[model samples]
Target: MPLQFQDRVVLITGAGSGIGRATAVKMASLGASLALCDINYDNLESTSKLCGATTPKHLDDVDVSSNQEVRKFVDATATKLGRIDHVFNCAGVNPTSIPLEDTTDEYWDKLVNTNLKGVFNVTRAAIPHLKSGASIVNVSSISGLRGSAQQAVYCTTKYGLIGFSKCMALELGPRGIRTNVVCPGYIDTPTNAGIVKGGEAVERMVNGNALGRLGTPEDVADVVAFLFGEESRYMNGSVVEIDGGIKGTVLGGQERAKL
Candidate 1:
């Protein structure tokens, strides 16, 4: 049977852009009732329109780092939508590359709060509303799997998410709720516009992937949708990579370029 989410309610963070926005549109097309939020109200509104939501009461400006805001939004979604069947934790901040020695306390706190604590706040608040078969997908990055220079704090938060999701899976699996993670590598999103604006940086990334192309938001969204459906009901605490085969290339960078 084809995948369908009719009458299901899905709450999506970072619904303003990139993978989150793409997922919102995809789920809406599949007949899901959506509740979306983002720090940017304008972009959030645009995403709501794309989803064709008639009323946007459950959608608003929400800073995921704030527990109070997260709790309020979660309650509103449960109250307005009658239930929350799935949660897509896609809200996160792009990391600024800087040497470890130059990393400021302020910058570290910013990344930790949004990338790590934000997921905590949402999951904590939504746990009460979620019932059997509910799925929670947290977005991490390829940086979580391995180390990268000048990305200490970013890697920390992403790596923490993997651990956190696994724990949630163990705790909630008995209750029939599944938790999972998606790690995307070099996706061509607006958040990475500067890096992909046309230069050696973009070319290097394209070559790094075995598929020889950067992943798109839709690419990740399709996988997210599958995880939410029954096709992946047995999947829990799984860390899925949506990077166009970046994890499979065995050749050195110089040698791989020849292919």
Candidate 2:
């Protein structure tokens, strides 16, 4: 059966690339109205166009770290759209390998602000506008569950998302607002375009998982769509892992060196 999200207003951050872009298209195909946000204007507009959305306004330069900005963005989206049903927090950064000892204050702050606090700011602003039974999906990573060398900052932010989602689920479930985390494995997108630029990351992902290949944005988007629809009405406060089951692969080995 086709999943219908007709007229449902979905606000998605990081709508310019990767899983976020895929999710926007998927929902839009199902007739969902969308408010797409991203720091990259061109790609964000491209995604909106691909969805064939009318009134697809783009918001570039949103600093998710600032509560004021987050509130303003949500208010603006809601004012423009009139209603909000689903919110996807997907903007994030995975900087190059840098030792924790060598990590600077600026580097760490940006990561934390965008990754962890970013989700918090957006979700917090949208909560009041969310109708009962509305859903919030936070984009987390397997890095939160497990760790990687030289990725202390990334790990911390993702792990924090998991914790934040669970608490929101608990606090808002009674109001019929569902909160959940979508923890995707390695997915090919512009964020990690550097890795596949040389074909090295693809090779590691192919050998690292039970699926024997890297995950496409559509793969993750399918899961996200389910969470946003009636199919998952009873699912909340859950951490759904979408990796190829590479939980035990050797850290930084050839299995997932690309990540």
Candidate 3:
């Protein structure tokens, strides 16, 4: 039988585009009711339409970095959807990469607050409303598992997510709630548009990965769905890497080139 979410109530942050949007569409197709939010109203509306959700209560313009806004959104989702069975904490930002010395306080603050603190705010607020069998899937990056060049702030935030999710997993486990983090590599999303347009850079990235191609939002969404379902019932406090084996052989590529 196919995986199904017949009556599940799912709350997805960053549901405007990319993986979040894909997940929303996928879950909706599987019969899950969605409460989606993003900072971009236009994109959020587009996603809602794509999911065929016409109700105003199903969508919101929420900045995950703000505790008050997150609280309001979560409260509204619970009020509208009744209860949240799964949460996809996918709202995040990726500023231009620069060397550590060149990084500004403003840039660092923006990334940290949105990426790290954002996840915390949403998850913290939703915890009280999450049912016993609830699942929380946080979207980290391959940079979280391993450092990247000229991405000190971004890496820091991603790494923080891993630790934060692990702690939540442990604490929520006793209550039958599961928390897991997904680390994706070079996914073909708006955030990586620059690299995708840079012909040679894109090739280099593909060559670095064992799969020999960039991942699509759907690839990650499938895994997110798995983690949210009963198949992953025992998968608490786990860090799943959906990087197409890039992390395993990234350094090996350098060694081979040196040879």
Candidate 4:
């Protein structure tokens, strides 16, 4: 009747906030044992407290960018939880919008390391501990599907992540470990809150979608949960967009209406 993850272990990166925090809560509510990590220990602690006393949880301050940190966390999770059933690579960064020419080497590396290579690091470390029926959901962005002004580096990382996930899916498919990607647009979380400029920009983003509203972290989290669970067992190497129907066209009349 309900989504069931009882006795299953879920390893989540960037679990301190945004979609990662929301997914941790969702998995915990479904009775999953969680291994949660974020670069910020204080925020990670807050997320752990939000998961409540009932959820079996392990907390770590981990920068997903570091292969060493990721490997240590992955090993610790396997040791503490015994096995890993699902992985949500929700750790990422959105840099300030800037001209491509003005983008600094440091800025480029920061986004690439955290957004793309970070997923690679975690996935590589977690793979050995995963077995049949294990699921992996990498959080991407709609920017990866298309492109955006002033988001070159961020978009590049996300696009690369999609490709990487697809390869993993094909490679892990025979082994029965499914890999998928989630592309979320205009999610109104602390992550986006830091970037959205003014009320006008917010209004434009809200109206740009068929839903005419910003999506919550919970919205994306729901889809991630489905991908992790048996409900989406047949899905692999799938790239799902969690946008609120942004710029989607409806097929009907000569002048296509927006969906």
Best by TM-score: 4
**Which portions of model 2 miss their true places by more than 4 Å?**
1-3, 53-60, 250-259
* Per-residue lDDT of candidate 1, residues 152-175 (tens digit): 888899999999999999999999
Q: Is candidate 1 or candidate 3 better by lDDT?
A: 1
Better of 2 and 4 by TM-score: 4
lDDT of 1 at 145: 82
TM-score of 4: 0.93
Model 3 C-alpha lDDT versus the unseen true structure: 0.82
Per residue, candidate 3 scores C-alpha lDDT tens digits across 73-184 of 9998888878888999998886455888998999999999999999999999999988789999998887788776677787789899999999999999999999999988
In candidate 1, where is summed lDDT lowest over 10 consecutive residues? 250-259
lDDT: worst 10-residue window of model 4? 250-259
In terms of TM-score, how similar is model 2 to the real structure?
0.92
**RMSD to the native, candidate 1?**
4.2
For model 2, the local distance difference test gives 0.80
Residue 198 displacement (Å), model 4 = 3.9
Candidate 3 residue pairs in clash (backbone atoms < 3 Å)? none
Query: What is every candidate's alpha-carbon RMSD to the true fold?
Result: 4.2, 2.4, 4.4, 5.4
TM-score pick, better of 3 and 4:
4
